[model samples]
Target chain A: MKFDDLKKLHQKKYRQQFGHFLVEGEHLVLELQRALTRGTLASGSVTLYVSERYANFASPFEKVLLNDRQMSQLSDTKSPQGIVALVPLPEAPTTIQPAGKAIYLWQVQDPGNLGTILRTLAWFGGFRCLLSPGSVDPYNPKVVRASMGAIFHVPLELDVPLAALPDRFARIGCLDLHGESVVADNFVAQDCFVFGNEAQGVPREALSAMGASAFTIAGQGAIESLNLASAVNICAYEIQRAQG
Target chain B: MKFDDLKKLHQKKYRQQFGHFLVEGEHLVLELQRALTRGTLASGSVTLYVSERYANFASPFEKVLLNDRQMSQLSDTKSPQGIVALVPLPEAPTTIQPAGKAIYLWQVQDPGNLGTILRTLAWFGGFRCLLSPGSVDPYNPKVVRASMGAIFHVPLELDVPLAALPDRFARIGCLDLHGESVVADNFVAQDCFVFGNEAQGVPREALSAMGASAFTIAGQGAIESLNLASAVNICAYEIQRAQG
Candidate 1:
């Protein structure tokens, strides 16, 4: 891809149009290669771009050599890591399988929060991320970068409507101030944990539609709420703990 | 304060020199006021600055109205929240009492990570945060902002060397890959949970000095590690869970 076209991958529109997204830094490129080796990703779906300094780095996919200026132009970060990969965007599944773990987000606006949530989900494994319409693009460079390469490992369904969650999962859980304690032995098995926007929490109507049960990570301090990602992390960990 | 001087609060040097820091946004300002009302914060230690738009907002501290431009100048965020507070930095205590919850961060470089950890610590309550010498400044504007006013709620001790931890806490727990599972029944009560830098784990010597016991949050997936803040959150939650 031309540097101009590669740079366009930084934006959501270009990523959607080209059906590809950029992954930078050596760590992520290594992760992409690992996914390919594991047959989790298609072999020819990645195109690696590297500066001359890193041109000799062993990569399984087709490689493009670029100068520092071209590499910098293609990078989303201020200090370019000299390696970028254009990976085909995996098709979002229209229907999700029931019975496994899943996380549903409604209009989560922060890329960092989305990324960290994905990382947590990937760490636990067996969890799919369902993003409601109007959520930040999962393929946004910031999200991809912050995900620490979990973007490749975790399955993501984009533009999922909150109203449709009931059809997809058996139990839907959400965090709320007046919810059941997540640590309670009576906390039901939830296939989907729905998180809301950072500012405005899960809408009441949608919660009722999904028959969502509220769960709270009870704490002693004066904080009004935990950061969205932290809440998800604690919830995911609790699920793992319960299963173990 | 002059605009130039107000702008200087963004830097750690200036904050240290002036013995004060800035808090922005309506939520944090309200939190500051709440802290004052609850007697958690000293009166007359906060100087609120507001744009004409928010001039009528009730605050316990003295308020200075500023123009939009001046408000923007005083704010650290790209979009000024039109409210700012100059808050005096609490004096770091020379010694910490043993037998309560505490978190120790060593060389944690990310301001956001430090901030989120503080927020988590505050939410758990009865927890003090101890920063080893090389960690990011808890008072950095980004840290303070990301803290969501937890900066005011959580007690912090800066520039604490790791070697001094044993003198303060009897049991120091550190997360590790090969350690005892954090969810295990044998997980002991620890006065301090030592978290390491984002990239580097805790220094070997320091961990040894603290007699830090290792604990792992077991996961099935191939993720190399969890985000530092997420790890800390999980640890804090586990501590709360064990106690409850």
Candidate 2:
């Protein structure tokens, strides 16, 4: 791809037009290399771009040497880290199975929130992330940076509608104010744990459908809600504890 | 204070000089009102600023009417929310008496991370937050905005030195990779839970001093580490669960 085309990867339209996304910084580039070594990512799928300063950094993949100006143009952050990688967007599975633990986000609009949730999910492993329509683009530059390389590790499915969830997952769980306590011994493993938007929460119809499965994290304080990522992290931890 | 002086509240130096901070958006202003009602915050301390459109919104405290341009000048966000509050900075206690649950952050540089941690601490309630020297200013505009009003609810102590901690608390807990699992039945309450920087874990000297008290959150994946705020949230939740 030309440098002009590479710059287009910063926008979702261009990323979609050419099934590729940009991963910036040394840490993420190293993670991408590790992913390739682990076979989670295909070999020769990453094209690395480095400035003169990082030209000597060892890599088995194709390397494109770029001047300082080119490196700055390709970076999404101020003070470019002098290195970036163009990797093919991971393809989503056509069918999501209902067997293992998974997270489904519905209309979550914040890129940082989605990125943090992905990081948490990646840390816990064994979970896939499904995004309902209207959620932020997981491939957005801010999301990828905030994810701290988790984007390359976690399996993701995008643009999955809420109506399609019931057909794929036998058990669906969500958080609600008056729901059962998450710490209760009765807390069971659901095939999918659903979270809603930052302000709106899970849709009313979806909550009603999942009625008894809604759970709350009991607390002694007056805080109205937890940050979306924090809620997901706590829940994911609890699920892992239950399995143990 | 003049509008020019109010604009200065966006910076930590100005906030300290004037002993005030800015809270943006309607949700946070409403929370401030609630805090006044609950006696958690002083009743007359908040000065609300709203554009002509939000002039009709009810507020218990002093309200200043500003035009669109003035509102934009006072806001930190790209799109102004039109409503803001100049709140007196909460005074920190000179001496921290660590009698119950508390969180201590050391050299945490991100305002968003600090704010999210404050939100989690407030949700659990009955906990105090102590910032070791070099941590992000808790009163920064970005921290206040990301905190989602928890800034008004949680008690905070700033510029505390690590050396002072041992004199105040008998037990201190921290997260470590090789420490005991947090889910272990032997997990006990510590007067303070200490978290370090985003990229760097707790300082080696501090960890060595509190060696036996360190704990780890067991996970199934290959993630190197959890986000600092997420780690704090999980630990706080586990502490609350243990107490119950």
Candidate 3:
């Protein structure tokens, strides 16, 4: 396709109807291409649409071709990496099945924190993530950027009502300052991990109703609690290790 | 001081000439005030400047008041919390001490990461931070925000050349992917912890010539290492635990 045609995709109108967003950068483009080639996509197929004028773009993907100006318009970055891809948003996984190894977030408001935590989950394998109704939309642009493509690998289910969580995944743990030590040997492997709000933490009513136990990641000195992103990383890693 | 006068301090020129910047918010304002009351500063010092209209801005600190407009100009935040202070810049700390425990960063570019690490250090307790030359300026606004008030509590010294570091901090452990397991039982507590750039990690020159022993924070994950902030938290916690 011509370069100018790709540039037009940046508008919200085009992005919505087409169900695709321009993802730039050679590394990410190649990764998406690999996923496509491997048939790992959750739903609609991604097309390697490119223009010949932009052929010099140094991406790892086998397929690529786009004109320079065309790819540049699709990029959100200040310095375009000379490549862009039109990727279908992965279909949200259905039949979560409460794998007895999952993460639940309650109203995690910061996009950056949400994305960072999502990336952390992808790093430490095992564990699906479910976002309660109040949580920010996972597909928000800031979350997508901070996640650094981890959203593609991690199975994140959003807009899930808290009441819908199943009982077999019963080992729900919440992080609270008053909770037990996270590092204790008694830490058990469970399916459900619930994180609360950024400022107020999980609502008291939600905590009470969930009947979830609480545990704190211990630190000796001055911090109130780890930042939400940091807390998630610590919890996710420890939980992954404990289960393994 | 009237509110109009207080508003002028947010500008870089005013901050430099006055040698003070507004550190507002309930937590930060309280922390600075506490330090002042403890006689941490010289007598007749802390100008607990706030707009007189903001007299309702309650704090334990004795107010040498300013007006609303002045407070707004001095604040970096979009909405001034109605309190601002014109405290003196802290005297540069005395000679950099390598007193058996230290945190070092080499080309750690992100201000948020630098500030967050400083906060983590404060939380872990008993450690001094040293930033290699070319690292992010310690006082960047984003760094200040992410560090919360830990920036005040943690002593961060920057501009030290990396090459000269080992001469003072002899026992330096470089955090690397290929190094020995940092979480293993055999891991020993070291006098200094060195982390490299986030993208490139520690440069080979520093790793080889400085004679810093290598250690890896164990993560069998997708990405190479934890986020810079998360890695710092884990390291600080590990150090404190090892000491205990």
Best by DockQ: 2
lDDT of 1 by residue, B83-138 (tens): 99899888765455834688888889998888888888888887888888877888
Candidate order (TM-score): 1, 2, 3
After superposition on all CA atoms, what RMSD does each candidate show versus the true structure? 1.9, 1.9, 4.1
DockQ of each: 0.73, 0.74, 0.43
lDDT of 3: 0.67
Give the C-alpha miss distance for residue A212 in model 3, angstroms.
Answer: 0.8
Q: Which ten residues in a row have the lowest lDDT in candidate 1 chain A?
A: A91-100
Predicted candidate 2 versus true structure: per-residue lDDT over A108-158, tens digit per residue: 888888888888888888778889888899999899888888888888889
Per residue, candidate 3 scores C-alpha lDDT tens digits across B40-151 of 3433355666666657777665676655665656677778776655555565666656354778888898876777777777666687788887787665556766777667
lDDT of each: 0.83, 0.84, 0.67
**Per-residue lDDT of candidate 3, residues A1-244 (tens digit):** 3455556556655555656666655555655555555555554445454556456554444455655664556667676666566666566666647353678888888988887787777667676788987787666556766777666667777677766664545667778777787776555554577787778777667667867788877665455656777777777766655665
Clashing pairs in 2: none
**CAPRI grade, predicted model 1:** medium
lDDT of 1 by residue, A1-244 (tens): 6667778988899999888999999999888887777666744768888998888999888888988888888988899999989999987654548345888888999999888888888888877888999999999989988899888888888888888888877778888877899987655487788887889788887798668898888877577889999989998888888877
Give the CAPRI class of candidate 3: acceptable
Instruction: Give the runs in model 1 whose Cα sits over 4 Å from its true position.
Output: A1-3, B1-4
